[model samples]
Each structure stands twice: as C-alpha cells, then as structure tokens.
Target chain A: MDPISLAFGLILDPYVLTVMVLAGSFGLFMGAIPGLSATMATALLVPVTFFMEPVPALAAIVTATAMAIFAGDIPGALLRIPGTPASAAYTNEAHTMTMNGKAEMALGLSLTGAILGGLFGSAVLATSAPVLADIALRFSSFEYFWLACMGLTCAAFVSSGTAVKGFVSLLLGLFIATIGIDPMSGHPRFTFGNVDLMGGIQFIPAMIGMFAFAEVIRSVTATTPHFRPPQERIGNIFKGLGPVLMRYKVNLLRGSVIGTAVGALPGAGSDIAAWISYAVGKKFSKEPEKFGTGHPEGIVDAGSSNNAGLGGSWVPALVFGIPGDSITAIVIGVLYMKGMNPGPTVFLYQPELIYAVFLSFFLANLMLLPLGLTAIKSSKRLLLVPREILMPIILLFCIVGTFAINNTVFDVGVMLVLGLIAYLMEENGFPIAPAILGLVLGPLLEDSFITSMIKADGDLLAFFDRPIAAALGVVTILIWIVPLVVRLRRRGRLPEGVG
Target chain B: MKVNDAVPGAILIVFAAGVFQQTLGFPPMPGQDYGSRLFPQVIAGLMTLCGLSLIATGIANRHSEPLFVPAEWMRSPPHFVNFLLLVGLLIFYILVAGWLGFIPTAFIILTLLMTRLRGRGHLISTLAIAAVASLVMQQFFGQLLRVPLPWGIVPPVYW
Candidate 1:
C-alpha cells in the first residue's frame, strides 16, 4: 500500500498498457493530420475515457497528448502544413529543412528533442508539484484574482499579432463565458430563454468548433491543391540527428527549462512556450540569419520546448486546480469528474494516483520515440489519403464527437454556430488561442474577482493588501503597462534612432 | 470574402453596445455591491475601446496593398456556391438528424459533400466510405458508449 507499489500496480496493469498503446496510435493519427490538433484528439477521447478507471483514464489523456505533440511535426516536415498550433511555431523551419533534402534529419530532431524535453518536464512536475500545491493551498480569492489576471495578460501579449487584436479576441471569449447563470446570484445572465444556454456553452463542443470545424471550412474553401505527396523517402530518421543534437546541446537544454517554466505559469501553454523559445533561440544563435532557411537550430529549441510544456502545464493544474492552458483546463474538468479534485489536499489524500499520473508522463514520452519514428516513416502514405475524402470524414467525427459529449444535438448546433464565428474571426486576423484561454480562465477570473470584492466590503484597495497578491498585481500591471511605455518612448526618439 | 478591417471593428462596436445595454437591465443583488452586470459592463467598455482602435488602424492603412488583397476562392462563383451548400447541408443535418437517424444523416451529408468537393466521379467510393463509417460509428457510440443515437427508420441491429 506504499506510494511506489501502488503507482507501479496501477501503471503496469495489462489494461492500462493496452489503453496507452491505443491512445498513442490515436494521437499519432490525429497529430499527423494537418487540420487535426492535440486538443481535438483529447476532446475525441473524452467519451471513451468516461468508461475507464481513474488511472487508465488519466493515462489515456497523458499518452495521447504527449504523442500528439510529437507527431504534429510529421506533417510539418513532410508538407508545409502544421498539424497543431504548437508545431506551427517551427513549421516554416521544419518545411524548409524538408525542401533542403533533410526530411529524415528534421523529423529525427523533432522526435529526439521532444522525448528529452518531455522527460525533463515530467521530472520537474514529479519533484515540485507537492511543494507548489502547499504554497497554493495558502492562497485566497485575492491572490487567485491576480494570478488569473497575470495569465490573461500573458496570453494576450505573447501572441504574434497585434496586442489589441489579441485582447479583443480574449474579450470575446470572456463574453462567451458569461453566457450562462451567474455563479454569484444563480441568475441567468445571457441565456435569452434557451434552457440549454443555462448550462453555458459546452467547452468540448466550442473547442471542436473553433479548432477543427474552422480548419475544415478553411481547407474546403481553398483554391490551391495541397495533396501532392513528397517524392523523398524518409529512411533512418536517426541517421543524421546526432550531429544536430550535439551542435545544439545547450539550446535544447535552455529551451526545455524555459518551456517548463512557462508551462508551469497559469496562463501560458505549449504553443506560447514554443514561440518564445524559438524567438529567443534565434536571438541568441550565432547564425541567426540561417533561421527560417532550413536551419535546425530553432527547431531543436522550439520543438523541445513545445513537448516539454505538456508536462509543465500539469504543475498548476495538479497544485491548485487552476489550468495552465486549454489542455489542462480540460484535464481539470476530467479530474473533477473522476472525484480527484486537484489541490494540496489531493496530494495527501490521493498520493498514489498523483504519482501514477506523473509516471504516465514519463512512459508516454518514452513511447513517443518508436511511435513518432513510425509515423514519420509512413508520412508519405498518410499524406496521400486525399483531402477530398479525408475532410468529410473529419467533419463526421466533429459532429458525432460534439454530440457524444452530452448526447444532445443542441451541442452540434452550438458547434456549427461557433465554427462560423471562429472562421470569420480568423479571417479577420484575430487570434483564436487567446479566446480559448479566455473561455477556460473566464469563470476562474470572475469567481475570484467577485469573491475578492465581497471580502473587501467593496473596497478595491483590499486586493493588494496581501504581500503575494501585491507582488502578483505588480507583475500583472507591469506586463500590461511597460510595453505601452516603451512604445511611447520609441515614438519620441524615432528620428534620432534613425539618424 | 475579405473585407476591410473596419468591418469587424464596426460589428464589434455594435455587439458591445447591445451587450452593455443588456447588462444595465440586471437587478442588483442584495448585500452585494458588485452584481452580475459589473464584470460584463467592464468587458463591454474595453471592447468598445478595442473596436475603436481597430477602426482607426484600418482607416489609416486603407490604401495599403495588403488591405485590398484578393478574397481567394470567393472570386470563383462555383466554389463559393459549393461552400454555401456545404454550410446549408450541415444545418440540414442538425435539423433532421434525429428523424433521419445519425447513421443515414451523416452518411448522406458526407457523400454529398465529397461528391460536390471532388466532382461526381467518385460517388460509389464515397458512398461506401460513408455507409461503412456511419455504421461503425453507430455501433461504437450506440452499443458501446450507451449513447442513444436515434435509430429512426432502420431496423435495430445490436451488433
């Protein structure tokens, strides 16, 4: 009945191993497809996990997500299309490497780096989650408000597009989040007499609509053909990977550390971690100009960071029940459903379960090596599946997947409506990820804000009374204000700088 | 079709106005200084500012080549028609899916979409794919997951 033995017994069961392999294959399929994503893969698995035990259920998600993040690079290397947003950060560099006749090397680099980063992140989670959870157990509504604010700001500012557009997308998500009954008063806010709306928008359906449905529409509407399979055969993916790994050893380690830290943050996730690491990698590289020109340096850093972030994201979710990103948001919901509410108390009550979850991260990443290489070897065949036939099947999955969530056709309608809106939003250059982050964090933000207000007797200054809250508030304010200050300062000295 | 950036901004402004007005109608809670309307109103206020900024930016760059970029497939009338038809088909499935049953409904839509998107030559192949896929999914969800996907006109097959 010790923690180690319990963890081993849960993980080593034949049923658990079978689920891991099956989920790993499913994740590979979803991640290797250009229009599918890791989030969608998780969403699709939710119904299946409903029938599983707690450990197997958690294993299903953990294995699928880790494999999906790595398999995303397969399409990016074979074709220019990125399979997931996390892979999108280095898609151009990966494709350029393929065009340069190093497809094997490119895929190998992604596979090896992802495995290393995931292992490193899992180690961090195993060591620090209990300690972090203890600290988080001391937090009140005021501290939570600042934490959520910090997360929202990070998501908005870290986007690659204009800050205002990102913020607008975020606001739209918050608005959507407000559509159900107000938690404070038990009064409906924006349901408009539809009984289904009282439950608010379903997260799984909305996510499927935004990520999968929008992509389907985009792919169907495109005039250009993208189905041409690459002529180059990928053989011995690990052949030339050693030199690249040796050359960029420090970058890989740096990216893993940076990625894990960012993933541990409440708002930031794998995509943001990949983007920042790629930018930083380019900034610090000796041959920065070689980037985006088939260079493996950035891929070594960003690719590793993206997968490492999968483990890192679990930190906050396990510690405080606050999701680190959209994936963890879904995980938190599942954890609650399984009667394993996340917090410092859970570490004491369900120590074996928590340790088993952490152990699954290790197994999933180690499994990524063989599964990822197999996916890469067969990438050409996967590409030839023909979008004309493939797209409709994906559409079918979306409809059924959305319906499976609640066994109601109402969710299907919601999916279509959100899909149309998301398509338009993306067309207008508004980023969707921040909006997703908004939806996931919106309730948390509102609950904490309202609770803090009530606790303070309507005094806003009380939000800063606690030392940790004050520090978090200061950091959040700086994240928002400093960028504006710097922009204003640059405008005044533009002529002098140019001269 | 691609529109001026100002179009989205203008739409957002109207949306924010409507939401802000609705928030004003919520009754205040007893003993609570901040009601349900407060957070929504704050969001509306920020949205208004963002919309205005987008409008200004769009107008400032109205003459840029990027702003006038082609709307891609929308310029082709047939492609646009097919896109609308697909959207309509999805709505149709949502409405009649219960009566027609999930398997038949999904199968029909998938066949029509594939034929329209790829031209009509692969109808038989598309039909087989749709039929087999729908049946497999029906068994998986209905029998395995215990989800009651409407059986409708088809005879019950446990397997």
Candidate 2:
C-alpha cells in the first residue's frame, strides 16, 4: 500500500480515533485553566501514552498540543488571564474585547485563525519534511554535532532571563545526562555506586518533575487571592466570522508564514511565534493605535501563529532528531523509547508512521473546531474548577505517572528530588525549558561529538573538514562569538564614568 | 525563597570542581586519545566559567537587589503551611506508599491535602472526592495500563 493509504489506515483505526478525541478534550481542559499550559498537558500525557502503540501515542500528543494551543485563547477571552503562555501575547487585547462584550467574536476569531493556520502549517509539514529528510540523510557525526550544539545554544540564548542563567540550567541538564554509564567507554561516570543510576535518569519522570510537579508546587505556594472568573454568556461564535476573516485575510496569511518560519527555528516555539506575529501584525496595521483596544488584528495574527507553530516544530524533530522546542524534546524521548528514533532515517524506515503523524495534525485541527467551540461556550464552568481541589488531584496523578514509568519507587524519588530542584531554579529566575532541551539533546550531542572526535583522531581541524560540517560549525561558533563581541563593543563605547 | 545569583553560582562552582575531580579518575580508553573523562571535563570547565559570570553579575547588582528575598507566601501562615504540607505529603508517599499500598496511601495523602487547602467545612466532600479519585486512579493506571501498583496487605481485586 502507498504510504498515504497506510497512514490513513493507521489514523482511521477506532482506537487511535478514540485516543485523539480523549486527548483533544484533555488538552482543552488543561489549556482552559490559567496556570496549566500546553507543555504541561503534554508532560502529563506521557505516562498514559507510555502504554499505547507508537501511532496512538504520537497522535495523542499531537492532538493534545494543537488543541491546547488553541484552547489557551478561551480563558484569555473570558478572564484576563491567558491559559497558556502562547496566549499571553494578546491576553490584553482579548480581555479588552471581552470587556467590550465581543466575547463571541474574539473567540470566533481565535478559533477560525487557529484552524486555518494549523492547516496551513500541516500542509507545509506534509510537503517539506520528506524533502528536508532527504537532505538530512547526508549528514554525518560532525554535522550532527554542530546541529546539536546549535540547537542547545539557541535554546540557552532564546530562553527568558540572563543568558548566563540559561547556560547554567543547560549545563545542569548536561551534567545530569552524564550520571549513568559512559556510552563511549562502557564505564560508570556519576552513578555513585547505585544500581538504578546505571541506566541514567529517565526523562519521563524528570519531565513530570520539571513541568507538572513543579507546577503543582508553585500553585500550592502561590499567595495570590483567588481570581473570580467572569460570568459571560457566549453566543453564536460563527455568526459574522466570515467578513472579519475576509477583512484580515492578509494578516492571517502573514501570521501563519511567520509562525511556521519562527517555529521551524530550533529552540523557538509557539509562545515566541505568537509574540513575534503579534508584534509584526501591530507594526503593519493601518490603525496601529487601535491595537490592544479590543483589536482583532493582532489576535488574528498571533492566534493563528501559535497553532501553526505546532506543526512547524515537528520539522526539525522528525528530520534531524533535534527538537524545535520543549514539546518536541519530549517527543524525541518518546520516539527513542518507541524505537522509531527520530531523524531522516525514520523517514526512510517508516514513512507511513511519519505520514500518520501528519494526518493526526490535520485531524486534530479539524477536531478543534467543534471541540474549541464547545470549550468556549463552557468557559465559565471550566475556569470555575477551583485550583485547591484540582491541584491535589494533579499531584496524585503526577505520583502515579512517575511511578508507572518503571514501576519503581526509585523513579518516584527522582521525580521528587528533581521537582524540588526545578521549583528552586524557577524561583531564582532560571528558565526550565532550556534545561529540558539540554537533557534531551545531551546524549545526542555527546555521542556525536565523541564519534566525530574518534573519527578525526584528535585533530580539531577535522571538525571543519567536511563542507556541510564546516558551514554548520562556523554558524554555531558565530552565534556564540557574535553575542559576546556585541556586548563588549557596547561596553567599550560607553563613557568611562557611566557607572 | 529566592537568593542572590552568587549563592547558586558558588554552589555550581563547587559542584563543577567536584565533577572535575571525579572525572580525573576515569581511566583512559585503549587506542583512543580521548576517553570518558573528556566530555564531562569540558562540561565542568564551561560550567565553571558560567558560574563566575553569574557571580560577577550578582556582585554588580548587589546593592540594588537583596541577597535573599523571601517569597510572600512565606509570610502567610496558611500559605506557608500549604507549601510545607504539599512537600511533606510527597515525601510521606515516597516513604510509605509501597508498604501501605497505593489506594490507602493515595486516599490519606489526598484527604489531608484537600482538608488543608479546602478547609474543614468540606470534610465529608473531601473524603468522598479522595476516595473516588484514588479508586479511579487505581482502576485506570493499575488495571487498564497494567502498572503493577503495589497492593501491600490489601487483597488484590480481580476484575
């Protein structure tokens, strides 16, 4: 059978369809909440996905994330709070719209934009990924080493807070990755004479710790007074959405394009894409002063962009085994566990599976229409689920999820310790995403570097011998050097008594 | 609580030094010039540089920022207790869940946390929610997913 038909067969299976619907609902719930995020939704789903076949597992994640990104806009329209960071870019604009009694229109605009932009992104993924994979198949360890470095470097730089703090978080992750046996020499590095440590830290429990459990801690410790969710009646969201789409058609297209491009960049994700798209939309708008005053222009752009980014991120993840964001970082771990290790080779070995993922993206975005509409209509009740009751339940789920990974208390211990550390790290203004990216990429980076070094026989110059490797190496080095040079130059230009 | 960057910086420096010290003992690989120690040492070296930079920044901003800032929750007795109870409950589960079993332990943890967070007025509701939640979790994770959650002294139920 053709890969397309095979993909269709896989996606159309009753089990996979059921998983997608359930996951879509789960994503909407998580994303409609203020504190929970799309990443958190994905993190929490990992344990359940652990038991499923690869197709359903990947489908569940894909469906959940896409739904979550779109659903984030719901709370942004209802309450002033964004359900996820991706919605944060336009939370004020959306809330202003709600204040103006245009709640249905605001939600309608977001929903329509998300679905359209997501489809556009899926189209690009379907057409472009295999082509990229073909080119990626030529890459060797040297090239891979540079790509991995570039990804990690981009993560550290793009993360919020000081670059130094991001680098520290990244280095912490790398150090943790080294705790098991040395893959190169078959000797233990940092196991501290423990048998469980020999296999290294499992990223699943670590992810639950960093994202879900840490969030639980944060929610419990928060001293802010409970927010009274606004009670609003949502009417026909589809009423009069067409002329608005027609009016902002150009913005929608621009946003999707920008979102895909930005999301395809390693380390940048939907949140960044949404911010950039919103800014771009505001910049080009004829009525720039009208922005943030119940304006739908920026909303149309960012709303679409964030959802479009979900598909765009998969490009690097599937083609290069380098994640484009923290979500894909988890996807890579799951891929490795499924033995369909992501990269160009996955395309060659199982094109059908890749197509299945693509199909699920389309299915998910289509499913988003009805499901998103339902969520918007029910926003009041969804937001009313008090955090006090929800949090303890989530904590229990975290414990169960962590324990199910290996059925070992040791893994649960790892979750607790790492979760505490993560809470402390975040409290001090350190970003957790880079650390996750670092942890996911650390093994790949080390392996590629070691293999390249061995092949080059200790000659540093050999790292740049290959044309592709040289180009990639130069780019990675320039990213590091350029920032420092700029900083130094700025310092030099300052007057002597400036301080 | 949040602390000055210098605190974590110094901690990282000491930790990196320990890593460097440990990596020094790794035996070199035969026939290869680089060994298992190379990657870790490089990481440790980079980490040391980052740590120094953080310390420098911390010192520069010392006057503007406090050396330590207690989170607002620390000042509120109820909020502080909530934070402590959450952490303490997790540790309690980690210590006793295996011997006491998943369901009972989950029930106790959930009930205690809910009562603290939700207050005593909803005691019956809290107990009911905790009971149903624990049972549902057991059914979902243990039976459906086959997670092998410990039964301990409780007789295992067959579906």
Candidate 3:
C-alpha cells in the first residue's frame, strides 16, 4: 500500500512500463507543440484508456499528464505561445530569456526545475495521503460546504481583475448553476420540466465550451498576436543545466513549495500556483528589478510551481474526493466510475493501486527531464505550422471534443453560446476566468451548503458549528476583507463615492 | 463601462421578489419557516444587492474611461454583429438538428459559418472542414463511445 509496493507494481508489468514511456513521450511531444494542450491530450486519450485495465491505464495517464505539464515549459521558453495556460506562469520571463539569446539555458533550467518540483510533490503525496485521507474522512457536510466556499473564494480572488468584478462573475456562475434540480428536496428549481434539463448541465460540455470554444472564438475574432523573432540562435536543449541549477537554487526550492501549496487548494489550480510562486520568488530575490525581461529565477519558480501542482492536485482528490484542478477533476471522475470510490475507504480498499499511482507520479517527474529536453530541442519547427491551417484544425478539435461529450448537438450549441458570451465579457471590462471558476465550483458550493443546513434541522449556524468549517469561513471572509483593507490603506481614502 | 449595469440590477430585483413570494406557501410553523425556496431567495437578494452596487459603480465610473478594453469596441460593430450572428446560427442548429440529423445540420451550419466568417474565396477549407468533421465525429462518437449519434428524418449519412 506504500511507495515500495507501487514501484513493484510498475516493474511487474512490462506492458505497463512500455506504455508509460510511450505515453510520456507522446504527452511531451503533444504538449511541446505551441497550440496543443494537456486537457485535450487527456480528453482524446480517455476513450483509449477505457479499453485498458483501470490500474495500468491510470498509471499511463498519470505519467502522461505530468509529461505534458512539463512539456508546456518548452513552448513557453522557445516560442512564447505557452503550450497551455499553466505555462503562462513563466511565459514573459522565459520568452524574454530566448530574446536575450539564452533559450537553451532557459529551457534547461525550467526542465530541471519541473522534474525536481514533480519529485517533491510526489514525495508529499506518497507520505501524506493516508493522513490527509484520515482527516478528510472526519469532514461532515458542513465541512464540505466550507471547503467548497474556500475553493471558490480562492479562485475568485486569484482572477486577474478588480475583486468586485471577479465576485460578480462568480455570482453569475452560481446563477447558471441554479438552473437544475435541488438535491435536498428533489424539487427542480429552474428546469421548467424540459426533459433535456433533467440531468442538469454536464460538466464535460461546459468545460469544453468554456476553455476550448471560448478560446477559439477569441482567437478567430481578435487579430492574431505574433511573437517577435527570438534574438538567440538557440543551441543545445540541455545546454548549461548545471550552473543555472546552482544559480537559482533558492528560487527553485521556494517555487516548488509554493506550487505544492496552491495546487493542494481546490480551484486555485495550476495557473495560480505558477503565478504565485513566480511573484513570491521575485519578491524575495536579491535583484527584484530585473524580473520581467530574461530572468532564470522567474522561469525556475514558475516552472517548478506548475509542475509541482501535478502531485499536489492528487492529494485532495485521493483524500477528499475533491479535485484541485481541471485535469484532476477528470481523473477523479474516471477513478470513481472505474469502481474505486475515492475517499478514506479508497486507502483501505485499494492501497496498492493508490500507491502505484503515487509511485508513477514520481517516475513521471523523473521522466520529464529526458522528455522535456527532446521537446525543447524540437519546438522551433512547431512555430512554423502556418497559423491559418493550424487555427482551422484546432477549431475542428474543439467542435468534435465538445460534441462528443454529450452526443447532443444542444451541448455544442451551449458551447458556441458560451463562447460568444465569453468574447463579449472579455471585450467588456468583465473577466471571464471568474466565470469559469464559478461554473466549475458553483454546484459543489450550493449542494453542500444546502445539505449541511438540512442535516442540521434548518439551522444556518451549522456551517459555523464545526471547528474546521468555522476556520474556513473565517478565512474566506478574511480573503475578501484583507484585500479591501489593504487597497484602502494604500490609497488612504476611498476613491469618490465608492462606499 | 457602458454595459448597462442597471439591467442586471432590475432583473435580480425581480427574481428576488419572485423567489421571496414562494416563501409564502410555507406555513408559519417553526421548522418550516425558511422552506425550500429560502436559500435561493437569499442568493437572489444578495445578487440584487450586488447588482445595485454594480449599477452605482458603473454610473460613478461612467465619466471615467473604461479600465480594461477601452472605448474602441464601438469602433468595430460589424465584428460584434458577426459574433452575434454566429450565436444565432448555433441556436438554430441546436433547435432543428434532432429532426434533421447530424450531417445535414452540421454541414449546413459549418458551411454557412465558414463562408460568412472567413470570407467567400476559401471554398476548399469550408467544404473540406465541414465534410471531414461530420465523418470523423460520426465514426468516433457513434462507433467508438456507443453514444448512438442521433439520426434524423433523413436517411443514414454513410450506411
């Protein structure tokens, strides 16, 4: 049930080992492509995994996801496109290094940092999951409601805009979430009795719509922003991995720690993890002013944080039946439907399988070094795919991906409608990230809160009765109020008729 | 800044009122006081409050410049209209696709959208993309996932 048994499980199966390497390589290659994404890679492969034994298939996916996440650093460093949004962490910093004629070193440092971060995360997952699961098992409905609130509050606050707008957007998400069945009473709130509405909005379609379609719509409508040609004739992929390691040692360590923390927080996800790590690293650095241009510190911190998020996300999922990121959310669904209900009982029921997945994470992180090196070396050609052709193919993928989820053209319609909504919201001052967060977390918050209240015989204070729930409530309120206090203190007075 | 924040406020106010009215159906008994509509009504009240706040903020910020995107949005109304038209097309496709089947509905929508959005001369991209999408999705979703893609009044697409 521990790391040793898990490692042995991988060794016992030659096919699983072979599959792991190939999947890792494939993930690295796909994620290295500037336009390709980890979510799509997983989505496309989920069907393939359906035919395989759950244990080995899960190992393959775990390895591939890590590789893909690490591979994202390649595109960010070489092409400045950020192969995925999580790569947005080190994007400006890493690409700036490429412009400054140090692309090879930049890629090498981040690749190394990603592996190290992944290892750190895996170590934490290996050691702490049982205890975490025990703690999670103690949670009541009240605790779950508080946790959901915390997750949403973290995501909403992390959104890159005025906090008020973020809250409003989150409110909009909660509003949309209300358009379905009420769990406690079994009374449908906003379905209006349409049979199609009976099942509520499927998460897969909504996710595909928000991330894939909305992004594509934004891409086609807006002027295609081009990156400046890299100033450096980039050399070897692993060039100068040694000195860059020694140079940003502190930054790398701090970033990995920050990444693991943020990733453990449900809904904050990978993007926030990387950004927070990079910001903290830069804040604490000896030379803070030289950050935006071409700083290895920035790349290491961001890259480490994002990669570390891989394992951190699993902690919550394995322990609490809660997903910390989008990919983890999908993984949780697959795990449950595979006949392994993930909770404290999962630890007791299937210890070896859980350990095997954890060990696979460790191996995957180690594999990232070689896979990421190949990706960095080969990323230059990806930028030359001709945008017009590439855009159409991506659009097609979005269409198929969105449609395949529900097999309903209605979902595709929803995707397009959401895309248009996303575009307008982007055009106007409103931030769309909060809307995504709201959509993802809204149902969890509503169901848990209502269930907890009902269990407590209509007492609203039940949420605060539990010590954990009370602490989370205090933290959520503090998350809102502290920022407001800081802004007012900084400005010395409220700007005009604000209050 | 010109997004008519008052509209959302009015909508929230009305929703809140509607939800609060449902609370009347519950007896004045102690445990039944809040009722099933209680939480939603509370959320609606919160939404109204926030919506009103937004209205007040929008008005205060009206004279000032838009913070994020700026005032150049009206500079390209046609582009916006194209997006709206795209949304409209999707709505029509969804409403009618069940009756017409996947291929015809998808092909029609895709071809029209490709022509309208990308311009008239890319005939090859339009046809190729439309046709290819139908075939691949049909095979993958219908054959692979076993979700049974909806067939319409028309004959089998390929069988």
Q: Which candidate comes out best when scored by DockQ? A: 2
The order by descending DockQ is 2, 1, 3
Q: For model 3, which pairs clash?
A: none
Q: Taking the tens digit of each residue's C-alpha lDDT, what string does model 1 give over A168-281?
A: 988988899999899898889888899999999977788878877887888888887675777888888888678779999999999999999998876678888999999999
lDDT by residue for model 1 over B1-20, one digit each (tens)? 55667767888899999999
Identify the leading candidate in terms of lDDT: 2
Candidate order (lDDT) = 2, 1, 3
Instruction: Please write out the lDDT profile of model 2 over residues B24-97, one tens digit for every residue.
Output: 88999898888889889999999999999989888998988778999898988988999889889998988998
Q: What is the lDDT of residue A493 in candidate 1?
A: 98
Supply the DockQ value of model 3.
0.28
True interface contacts reproduced, per candidate: 0.66, 0.84, 0.22
Off by over 4 Å in 3: A1-68, A225-234, A326-342, A390-396, A403-405, A429-447, A461-470, A473-499, B1-35, B66-89, B92-133, B151-159
The TM-scores, one per candidate, come to: 0.93, 0.99, 0.83
- Assess candidate 3 and give its lDDT: 0.70
